[model samples]
Target: MDPVIDVRNLVKRFRGTRRTAFAPATPDSLALDHVDLAIPEGQIYGLIGANGAGKTTLLKVISTLLLPTSGEVRVLGHDLRTEEAAVRSCLGLVTNSERSFYYRLTGWQNLRYFTGLYGMDRTTLERRARPLVDRLGLSRAMDRDYRTYSTGMQRKLAFIRAFVLETPVLLLDEPTSSLDPLSSEEIRSLIAEECQARDQTVLLSANNLLDVERLAGRVGKMSQGRLTPVESASDLDESLRVARIWLRDPRSRVEATLRTWAGGSPGRPPVRWEVQERNQRTLLRVATEEPERMLPEFLQFLLGSGLAVESVDLRSVDLEEEFLLAAREAEAEASGASP
Candidate 1:
């Protein structure tokens, strides 16, 4: 099946200004490196990245709000450049910024105005938008000027407005940035219902990994303009695990052995490790991107190295940790993107 969103070797760069004619020139900033992505139809695809990591850059390019310096991008099989209008018609985007909505207008008024952009009439707007406003706990404040609403309330309004369009594809950037925990969960539930029952396709970007882990059908980590998509949050978390090997004698050859293994060899995949002596005990924390496939061999190598077997503890990396590892891995490899 063709993907709802397709991006190939996408690159977005910002030109930098020079200080002086005699001074050295600054290179352009690379917001998006070579990125390749394919998001399937009718799925919640979660995108995560650090600040300046290119999450919003990718969304803007796919939404056709910003043009790529080079590379191909298609939305719902529509070329982003040639079919920008059609591609935009297929999307309902909610960006996370307090100023996006009008401060002078009421929440209800803002919703109506946005829906009108899609040619929605008053009756159609009132019918579809009111319930979402109420469902998001904006019923009381919908009639008040948006400037009077708190930041959280405005955020909730921004989320509700997207549904007014009822488009086939949604591009959300921090959909729950300022919401309370209960409200955040409510938005997630709404997203699930919309996607599963209506067959909508959503690409959501957020800083909170736990939210992504819970709501996304598939997960992706974006760093330094490259994206890596995973089948499941479990696939990313489980495949990349953190293991701590404790030693009664921190002075054992375990450190040397693990270091050597971590170093690149002719036939071995180097396992990342950090060694330290903590509280009079030696600690070697090893991280493997493919833990299920590598930990056993790592353990055998440990035993055979004549290291004292004090104890071994297996732990899983959280969403934040998983992103860090994935980001570091991407930067180190600096390879092209993946689906």
Candidate 2:
């Protein structure tokens, strides 16, 4: 089966500042660095990255809001350069910005006008949008000017419009941004239903790892303009667990020993550690994936390392920890690659 969205050797660059009378010239910055992605039908591909990491840049390039510097992008086999109109017809994009809507128009009016561009009449638009509006808690504000809506309401309006469009592919950037917990969950449910029931392909970029954990079938991390797919523990084995150990008054050698242990022998699970100043005491946090048989031995190793262990918390692995782990790994790789 052909992918619903295909991107190959994609690259995007923003020109840096030119030399001025008092400043030196700067090299161009790469927003996307030869990124390749293929999202299949009915799949939710969740993209997570830090600020300025090129997640949004990739989305905008696909949505045609920003053109790529080079390489191929296609939606439904329609080339983005030659078939932009066709590509646009196949995707509904939900951005966090309220600037996408007309300030003076009511939410309902904006919805009707946008859907009208897609050839949806009033009855069809209302039939498709009303339930989504109500479900997202935008029903009460539908008749008010969009500018009067709060940031969260504006985001809901964006979702309502995109959901009603019924496009085959959905490009969502921070769909749950500015939303409360309840609203975020509602949006997640709606996204899942749209993909599972309607078979719509969704590419979701979000900082909220929960959104990705709950909705995405595949998760990828974007770091320093490169895309790396990673398997979330939730989607993998249920036996995977994260243990966070807090140490009090730990010796300086405690960290070196822990690092050595983490990188020690073959077949050992990876461990990550960080120091924190908490409540006027020095605290050391060590997080690792420990299987049932390894926990006791790992604890003994820590005890023998001459470290004072304060408390240990163990639970199922979560996306938050996975996200942090990926970020730290990326930072480490970049650091090693630097001259």
Most accurate candidate by lDDT? 2
- Tell me the spans in candidate 1 whose CA falls farther than 4 Å from its real position: 21-25, 244-269, 273-285, 289-312, 328-339
lDDT of 2 by residue, 60-81 (tens): 9999989899999999999999
User: Positional deviation of 157 in candidate 2, in angstroms?
Assistant: 0.6
Model 1, 1-339: lDDT tens digits are: 999888899999989878897888788889888989888888888998776689999988888888899999888889988888999999988887878888899887888788888898989988987777777778889889999998778777777777778888989898888777887888788887766776888888988776688878888878778787765776665566788788766644655565566443456677656556788888767786777788787777777776776888778766666665555455445553220
Where is model 2 more than 4 Å wrong at Cα? 22-25, 236-243, 249-308, 312-316, 332-339
RMSD of each: 5.1, 3.9
RMSD of candidate 1 to true structure, Å? 5.1
